[model samples]
Target: MPMPAQEIEELIRAGIPDAQVEITDLAGDGDHYSARVVAESFRGLPRVRQHQLVYEALGGRMGGALHALQLTTACPTEE
Candidate 1:
């Protein structure tokens, strides 16, 4: 059971509140995805930690419903 892109985006937004996320299914299978997330919450966190936070938002679905995620996280840029 692959995770839906909307579900993954919802989870990330739930955790970060103000995340701007773009999701793509890399394998044409919902199980493999690529996500680019920009959030204010990432301002102080390391990239690894930011990724972990997003993974945690998935609630243990990483190895099961969600197979692989190529993620890019960043703090919102100053305008």
Candidate 2:
């Protein structure tokens, strides 16, 4: 079974309370998705680490309930 976009968003929010998450279904199949996540905690992290935070938020859902995710992560800009 495929995962719901809302579920993915909720999961991320639960893991990273301050994160801003946007999820897009690329294939309309619920099996593929793209997510953009921004958080203050990511400020000093490397890109690889930023991505890892998102993957961790998914709680090992990759390659299982969630098939694939194209993720982009960043820290909020200072004003």
lDDT of 1 by residue, 1-79 (tens): 8789999999888877888999999999788999999988889999999999888877888888889999999998899
Weakest 10 consecutive residues of candidate 1 by summed lDDT:
57-66
| TM-score per model over all chains | 0.92, 0.96
**CA lDDT of each prediction against the hidden true structure:** 0.89, 0.94
For lDDT, the strongest prediction is: 2
Provide the lDDT at 42 for model 2.
90
* Deviation (Å) of 46 in candidate 2: 0.5
Instruction: Tell me how far the alpha carbon of residue 38 in candidate 2 is from the true structure, in angstroms, after superposition.
Output: 0.5
RMSD of each: 0.9, 0.7
lDDT of 1 at 51: 90
